[model samples]
Target chain A: MNERILELFEETPETYVSGAEISRRLGVSRTAIWKHIEELRAEGYTFEAASRKGYRLISKPAKWQVSKLLNGMKTKALGQKVHIYDEVDSTQTIAHKLVASGAPEGTIVLAERQTAGRGRMGRSWHSPSGKGIWLSLILTPRIPVYFMPQLTLLSAVALCRAIQKVCQVDIGIKWPNDLLIHGKKVSGILLESSGEDERLKYVIAGVGISVNLLEEDYPEELRSIATSLAIESGGKVSREELVQAFLLEFEEMYALYMEKGFAPIRLLWEALSVTLKRPIRTSTPSGFIEGIADSLDDTGALTVITPNGERVKIYSGDIELK
Target chain B: MNERILELFEETPETYVSGAEISRRLGVSRTAIWKHIEELRAEGYTFEAASRKGYRLISKPAKWQVSKLLNGMKTKALGQKVHIYDEVDSTQTIAHKLVASGAPEGTIVLAERQTAGRGRMGRSWHSPSGKGIWLSLILTPRIPVYFMPQLTLLSAVALCRAIQKVCQVDIGIKWPNDLLIHGKKVSGILLESSGEDERLKYVIAGVGISVNLLEEDYPEELRSIATSLAIESGGKVSREELVQAFLLEFEEMYALYMEKGFAPIRLLWEALSVTLKRPIRTSTPSGFIEGIADSLDDTGALTVITPNGERVKIYSGDIELK
Candidate 1:
C-alpha cells in the first residue's frame, strides 16, 4: 500500500493524485485508501489531503528507502534483495544476522548513518546521515578461505571502477582494501567471512564510500586526509546510482573470480593499484620490512622483495611507500 | 551455581549432605538450595531430598555433561568451556551462536545426540544417543583463511593421536578430514570457519567419532563402510575420556602450529599416513584422476602425481584406492 502511494507520488510530483486514481491503480476502495493514508501519516509521512484533490505526498520519512532503490535494479543476484534502514549501528552487524538466518548472496544491508561503524582492525568509521554510503553485501563464494584476500581486493577494484565511471575521476586502490584519490583515503572495504577449508558459508563485504559528504561532513582530524564525491566533483551525486553501479560491477568481478579464478581480478587490481611495483614498507608482527612491491600471490598476499633480494609474502599489515 | 552443586554432588555421590552443610558450602540459604533443586528437577534431574538431609543427586540425564568434562581438564584453552546439550540439532549450529556472542577460544559445544548432524558435502551423519561423540571445538587461530585447509588436516592428525591414546588402535586420516580404521570409517572432521582475508574470527572444528556404536547402530547402508571404536576394539570407550584427550592433543598441536609452523605436524602426519606414496584415485568436479599419492604440501593439499606424471593438487573430493 505504501509502495503504491509512493509510486504515484513519484510519478505525479507536480500535481496532486486524486482519490479515484489511487483506488483504480491499487484496486482498493476509497475507505482502504484513506486507511493507508492514515497509516502512512502515523509512520511520519506528510500528505496534503483536500476534498477534491486526494493526497499530495509532502515527504517520505525514509530518505534512502529500499522501495526506491529496488525500482530500477537490473542485476541478476546482486542487489536483488536490499534491506534498508533509516539508522543502524553498522551494516555488518545486521549482515551477520542475515547470514545466521541463511540469507543468500547479493543480499544487501544498508543504512543512512552508522553509529558504531568500524573499519579494518576495529577502527571507527566516520559516517554521517545523508552523506556517505554505509552498506554491507552478503556474498557466498564457493572458494577456500585463503582466497578471501583476493575477494577483498576485488571489492576495492569494483568500487574504484564504479566511482570512476559515474564521477569521471581517477581512483586507485591501496594494497589490501582501501581506495585512495590523490593519496587521500576516500573509501575503505572490510571483508569479513564465515567459512571452512573447502567452501565459504558467507562473506560480509562492508563498503564505506564517501559519496555525498561535504568538507564539513568529515571530522576535524580527517579534514586534510579524507574526501568525498561531492567535495571532489562539486556536484550532488545520487547515492542510489553509485550503489547500483557498484553491485553490477561487483557481480561481474565476483562471478569471473569464481569461474576463472583470481588471475583476472588480480590483473585488474594491479592496473589500478597505488602500491604495486613501488618501494614500500609493511609493518608485520616480527618487525617492519622495507621492500619493493613485486606482485600479488595467488592467495592475495603482497609479494615484496626485501633489500637483501629475499622475497617475502606479507599476509596483512599497514603498508607505506618508502 | 550449577557447577558448585554439581561438584558437591560429585564429591558425595553415596551419602546425602545435611541442609545446613549444603547451605554453608554454597553460601546460600536453605530456601535458595531448595529452589535450585526444584529447578534442576524440572530440567529432568532426579534428586532424593529429605526434610533434614540435603539433596542427594540420584542421576544426571546426560552422563558426559559439561560439568563432568571440565572437572579436571588440564589444557589451557581447548574444552575449557564446554556447552553440553542433552539433544540438539547440531553442535555446529550452537557453536556459531557462541562465536557470535564472542565466546573465547577452546569453548566446546557437545551434544549427547544430534537429530540433524551433517558431514561434508551435505551428507547426513548418524548421531545416536549415548553412543557416539558428537562435538564441535571452537578455535580462534590467528591465521589467514587460506591456511584453513592445513588446519583441517592438522585437526585430523590431532584426532588420530587422541583416539589412539584412548582406544589403543591404529587409525589413518582419509585424505582431507576423515578418520579410518581397518579401511572403515571411524571418525570424521568438519572444519567450519568465520573470518575475512586478513584473520579468521573462529574455526568450529566439528569432530564426530563413532565411539560405542554397534554394527546395528548404523543402518544397513553404513554398516559395510562405517565402523566404531568399540566395534574395532571390542570394548566400550569413554566419550568423556576421548574428548578430554582430544582437547589436550589439539591444544598442543595448535600451540605448536602457532609458535612453530606446519613442519613438525606434517612430519607427524606423514609418519602415520596410510595414503601417502600409494596409488589412489580422486573424484573431482572436473573429472576423476588416478595418481600416486605422493605427499602433502605446506598448505595441506594432497599432491597426487597422475599416471602421466602431472601433479594435481586435489582440494576436496572423495578418494578411492586403485
Candidate 2:
C-alpha cells in the first residue's frame, strides 16, 4: 500500500532502500514499489533510488499536506476525501459546488487562506495566510435537514474541547457558533445545506478560527472583538496539532450524535452556553421579542420563555445577549 | 410615473399623445413625461411620437417579460424589481451570486427555460422551452433562517390557490413544497438561504411549474410521475395568466404572513394535505417509522403517530404515501 511506502520513507531519512527490500517488507512486486515511490515523489516527496540503495526520503513540505492530514484522521469517511485549494473565495461556496457534482460524503475543502472569507450574518472574516484553520466539511447525514441546528452546537463543543486540550484555556460557546475568550470572539461557524423536502443531499460546515494572528494582524475595527490563540496562549500554536485535535473531537461528537441523539449534545451545549438562562432580544421578520433562554429541545430548537412566560421556540435566528 | 405613463398607453392604444398632453393628463411637466417614456422604452417597449400621435404597445413576449410580469404584481418590495433571463443554468445559483453582490430585496429572476434545471433532492426537472415557469424570487425575510420551512408552506398555499383560480382544478400540498394533482407532481419549490445566526441575508425560492407542456412534451420516463397543465385541463393554459395569478396569490399570502402568523396558513395547509390522517412510511436518518400522520406542529414538523401509538414529531425527511 502507498501508506506503507510513506511509512518506510518516513522511517529511513537520507538512506536509500532497495526495491527488493520494499517488495519483501510489503510483499509486493518491485515494479509496484517503484510505482508507489514515484507517486510519493509526485506528492512532493524527494526519493533517491539506485540498484544498491533502494529509496531515500529527502524532504517533506512544511505546509499542510493531504497525506499528513489524513494520516491520523480516525473516521469511516469524514475528511477522507479532501480538496486542498491554494486560494479560494469561499470554502462554503466550493463545498456546495462539489456536492452538486456528486462529490462523496465527507469531502472537505481546505484553503491556505480565503480571498473572501465570510462569517456569521454575512460579515467578512479576516483569514490571513497560515494564521488560522479555514476549512469547510461536507456532511451527508441521514438525519432530517431540520435537525441541522445541532451541527452548529456540536461544532462549538468540539472547538471548545480542542482549544482546552491544546492551550488549556477556559473558553465558552456564545449561544450559536461563536467561540469567546473573556467575552471576545475567537472563532465562528456557519452551517449550510442543500436538499429537498425529504432528503438532504449534503450540509457544509464552514469553520473559521482566529488561531495565530497577532493583535496587529486583525482589522482595526475587529481589534476589540476578535482574538487569536497566539494572543491568548502567549505563544505560537501548531495549526496541524489543533486541526488534528479538532477533527478527532468532531468525529467523536458526531458518532455520539448518531448513537444517542441531540439530547446528550444539548446537555453539553447548555453547560457551555453563555446565553442559556439569560435574557436576550431576538428580532424576527415581523417584530422583536425579548425572552429568557430556556433549553434546547430534542430537535435542536432553542426554546425561549417570553415575558408572559409562554415558551416560543426560536428555530434559527441571531440572539442578542442582553 | 411610469405607472401613469403605462396607463395612458393602455387607455389609448392606437394614438401616441404628445409629451405636453401626457404631462397634462398626469399633472406633470413635459420633461417628466419624456423621462417616463424613456424608461418605458428601456424596458423593451417601443414608443412612436409625432406632433399628435401618441405611443403604441407593439409587442410583448409571452414568456416572463419584465414589464408584462410586473403589470399586476402587488407587494411593497417583493417582485417589484425583476430580472428576466432568456436562458440560465439555474436561477438559484444566479440569485446567490446577486445576493453576495448586494442585490436589493424583492429582486426576481425569471427564465424562459433552464439549460440545466434543478429540483429538490438534487433531481432534474423538465423545463421545456415556453412550456413551464422556471423562476426564483429573492426575499430577505426578517425571520430566523430555521423558520424557512414555514415559508415553503406559505408558498405552497399560494401556489395551490393560484392553480385553483386559474385552472379550476383541485391541487393539494403534499406535506412540503410539492403540488400534487391526483397523486402526481405538477410543481415543486426549492428554498435556499444565505445568512448567519438568526439573520438571513437573502433567501431564493426556485419554483418549477409544468405549465403548457403537452403529454408528448414530457419525457417518456416522467410521464407516469409528472403531469402538465395541458394534460390536466385538456386545454392549453396561458403562461402569462398563470404567472400573474401566482404573483398575486404569493403577494397576498406573504402579506397575511406579515400581519398574522403561520397558524392560519398552517390551518389551510392541513386542510389540503393528503398525507394527514393516513398510514405512511416516514424515513429519517436515524431509522424508518411507519405511522399515521396526525398533524403539523407549530415549527412545521409533522407529528406522526407511530404504529406503536407513540406520537413522533418529524422535523424533516421523506414520507411515502400509502
Choose the strongest candidate by DockQ: 1
Interface RMSD of 1: 1.8
Indicate the docking level reached by candidate 2.
incorrect
Q: How close is candidate 2 to the true structure, as a TM-score?
A: 0.73
TM-score of 1: 0.78
Candidate 1 structure lDDT: 0.82
Q: A225-295 in candidate 1: lDDT tens per residue?
A: 88988778778778888898999899889889878988999999999999988999877767888989999
Residue B186 lDDT in candidate 1: 94
DockQ of 1: 0.41
Report the C-alpha displacement of residue A179, candidate 2, in angstroms: 1.5
The residue-by-residue lDDT of candidate 2 on A165-208, one tens digit each, is 99877688877778888778888888776544434446788888
| Poorly placed runs, candidate 2 (over 4 Å) | A1-68, A84-90, A93-102, A195-199, A215-224, A277-294, A301-322, B1-68, B74-76, B85-102, B195-199, B219-225, B286-288
Q: What is the DockQ of the complex in model 2? A: 0.19
